[model samples]
Target chain A: MRNLDEDTITQAVLARHTGAPDARLREIMTSLVQHLHAFARDVRLTEAEWFEGIRFLTEVGHMTDDKRQEFILLSDTLGLSMLVTALNNRKPPECTESTVFGPFHVEGSPEYPLGADVANGARGEPCYVRGRVLSRDGSPVPGAELQVWQADADGFYDVQYKGEHGHRARGTLHADAEGRFHFKSIRAEAYPIPHDGPVGRMLDALGRHPWRPAHLHFMITAPGFERLITHVFRNGDQYLDSDAVFGVRRSLIADWVVHPPGPTPDGGRSEQPFYTLDFDFVLNPLAQD
Target chain B: MRNLDEDTITQAVLARHTGAPDARLREIMTSLVQHLHAFARDVRLTEAEWFEGIRFLTEVGHMTDDKRQEFILLSDTLGLSMLVTALNNRKPPECTESTVFGPFHVEGSPEYPLGADVANGARGEPCYVRGRVLSRDGSPVPGAELQVWQADADGFYDVQYKGEHGHRARGTLHADAEGRFHFKSIRAEAYPIPHDGPVGRMLDALGRHPWRPAHLHFMITAPGFERLITHVFRNGDQYLDSDAVFGVRRSLIADWVVHPPGPTPDGGRSEQPFYTLDFDFVLNPLAQD
Candidate 1:
């Protein structure tokens, strides 16, 4: 057998998989094959180098656990997660921009009524997030379910604190009859992804920094319509362009403006520092049931 | 913002990635994106479902250890390692055929002199392996370093056993001035990869079998030449066509016919069969360097 270069084998592997008839799948596989091969060829990978790569991935696997996802972190740092997220979601103008799931969501959040505070009195810049669910033609789709979850002001998810449950700023709410939803919550702040794992080692090797922009996570679902898991990003965060996971998008960016509000005691909770965002969502409906 | 189905989000992720200009890279990425996206679509992935995938991968990470690489096993079983190995090494005919490094190589291996059996005292049918290292022009390549390794008759490596110094089946030896090298070793046995980890779970999920054909590992290097890391797969192993990792190349298969030493007491423990095969390795000098 003739010796094949790195690119040739990649091409062959990719070749056997083409013509899947699912045009979307075809396009994606093609890109993945190309980039992966190029990355290998760019370095002129040696046998040892190749094995080393395999070994690195093996280590990545070993670093994963129930509480942490080093592989997800790896995909995040590599921008693969973001790249896939973006390629799949293209909203019509003026919709809430999508972001990565960020590997923190736990199922069956407590459902709250409309206008309730999801932040549960946590301290941070106060902001009101208001949005409406609508069909692609801009028709309001009332009574849709919205699940909102986010890391706390300290950048640690509720799950990370171990036994600290009892509502760590996560909840679900239904869109009102008018298709509008609102909630009072603290503004999202920039955070660092977990770095004490093998993913961190990989980042060190690649010379990449780990910082994500401030953002809010939302999952909305309507009967006879597709569910959307997306985000509204605070535009001014320093790590917007290169969110450790590359999750930022122009349409998703929201204004984190200073909006002072009158407040009583409780350490002047909202008296001075405050932020407000007026964001909306656009959704495509499932074709007639 | 509105909820989008997993397919839509997957597409959106790809859209955000700017296209690569390199033609080869572009071709491959296009396919990779397609396959990855298809996998996502095939499962009708959900935010939670995708998270579980991340979790599965995290467990894969958690399974890695210094002595064992679960991800390499994952890649090997999924046919990625071999595919990548084949795509990169484009050697001309008559050179040694390259194959994957079975995930057992430690950074340091013992060194031995020429004609020494790497398989020292391992109990099995005796086999004699001889090879010549030559350049493409048929010139003998003296001082060629041949670092050879193979699994035991029971299909477990010495490292896996943790007590043996490994049979003379593995060592680094320098070729003689005439380009000749010889070693004695027990015949290899087809082995099953580790099936207790996440990779094993993946194989179960994919409904694929796991079994690698018997083979001896070799790494041949000569100054100013392309190095070769390859395997000589046993010709009649049932797993040859379906080498769990897809590492079988028809050209690399070798027949080890039984040799009769006229009523030997060793095989005279004679229920065991034996064979001798004289294999040759020819490496090409790097054309540029």
Candidate 2:
């Protein structure tokens, strides 16, 4: 055997994978090996550092369960999740941009009608959310499903509060004949992500905070249109400019207008102050699926 | 708010870390984001593929435990460990080359005298191992510690059969006044790494195996010499050219001379056949403290 150096070792690694029957797998593995080697070289990572990484990854795995996804959190903190999202969702300017589908989402949320109160007494400032699901050509996408979820004012998802109330600040709504949908919920609040895990410790050591901007999670889907998983951030959120997960997009910011105690636009009387937010979502047509 | 495409979003992510006080953290994070984004772009990774990667990593993390280190195995298979090893251990050609410190090492091992048998009744061909510890200038390094461990001919480490014969095929010995040491052990054998976990599944999917070459692991240390972690592969082992961990180096191969059933060179009789392997290790001087 010839003495192997850095470059030849990398080449030897890549060459061994030539027999991978799947082309895509080979491509990904090749790039992954190259980039990983480069990262190690770029940092001159020491053995202790490598062992630390191993321990961190192990703890991240151990922290993961049905409710917590520390690996996704690690990826989010590292900006990998957003990078992958951007690569997959390259679209024209007219369409709504996408972001991370964070780990809090649950499938088959209860469907509600327009103006329905989905907050279920969760505490926060009262807010009215109205949105229209539109196509690229400004046409209504009636029957489009908007799966919405967000943390309560306490910054805890209903899942985190397990026994108190099931699935608070979460629901599914459909666009009407006019491609319009609305619901009532508490105003979203910026909150620190779960940082008690390994990823959290990593962020702290790196001098980065784990706060994501206040926003409502939305996964909108319609027939003949590409599904969009995104968030509607409150305009001028403190954390928007430095979202922990890097999921913020300027176009997804919603203007929340506060109102005096009076009648709501939906013809409902409110005893206390309330807020209203109106936004529109544009979905690109699915590419010949 | 403008819509975010790939480039703008990457910039935003990097910008969020500007407040990091440590310059090294900033540099590492910046390079990490760039390489990660580039890898995704190079592969044009799909959302499904991204999630698959996430799940794979999660499983790898879950498979890790006190005994099993799937992540290190993953690193080894991808040649990252060897790359880092090469980067850190660049040395003159005369100096003995280094390789990975595989996961089978045990601390506070039983110390044995020269010519003591380390393999206690393990089924394999009897072998005499003798080596010398020297400095870069060929001077003997007395009192150097030789921490030795390897799999028996049946390809099982002492740690594997934890309940049967605890701590077999492992011992630590020190160089004598002449920097010479010898030990009795079974012929080292090529062995497959643990293949029952997520890493195993990954190797299977990638059309690869988990077999390492026949070799003995050594960690030599002295007061003024840089620590040397390496392995001596049996010459002509089938897996020498394709070590599962990519840890083989030309200078680390050993020549094992076979002998007929007769009196051994160490003044011992062996009714069955036996072999002898003589090798020397050269340690580089310690770096300035």
Each candidate's fnat: 0.15, 0.68
Which ten-residue region of model 2 chain A has the weakest summed lDDT?
A1-10
Whole-model alpha-carbon lDDT for candidate 2: 0.87
Top DockQ prediction, candidate number: 2
State which candidate has the highest lDDT: 2
The TM-scores of all predictions, comma-separated, are 0.74, 0.97
Tell me the tens digit of each residue's lDDT in model 2 across A24-102.
9999999988888888888888788788777878899899988899989988888788878888888888999999998
On the 0 to 100 scale, the lDDT of residue A224 in model 2 is 93
Q: Write the per-residue lDDT of candidate 2 for residues B170-227, one digit (tens) a residue.
A: 8999999989999998899999988899888877878888899899999999998899
lDDT tens digits by residue: candidate 1, B1-289: 1233344434443443344344443443345455555554544444454566677667776777777777788666544576667666677877766788778765557788765667776656787777788888888999898887777888777777876564445778889999988776778779888888877765554445567888888888888998888888888888775566667777778887786555532233344566776678778679893
Docking quality level of the chain pair in candidate 1: incorrect
Candidate 2 Cα errors over 4 Å, as ranges: B1-4
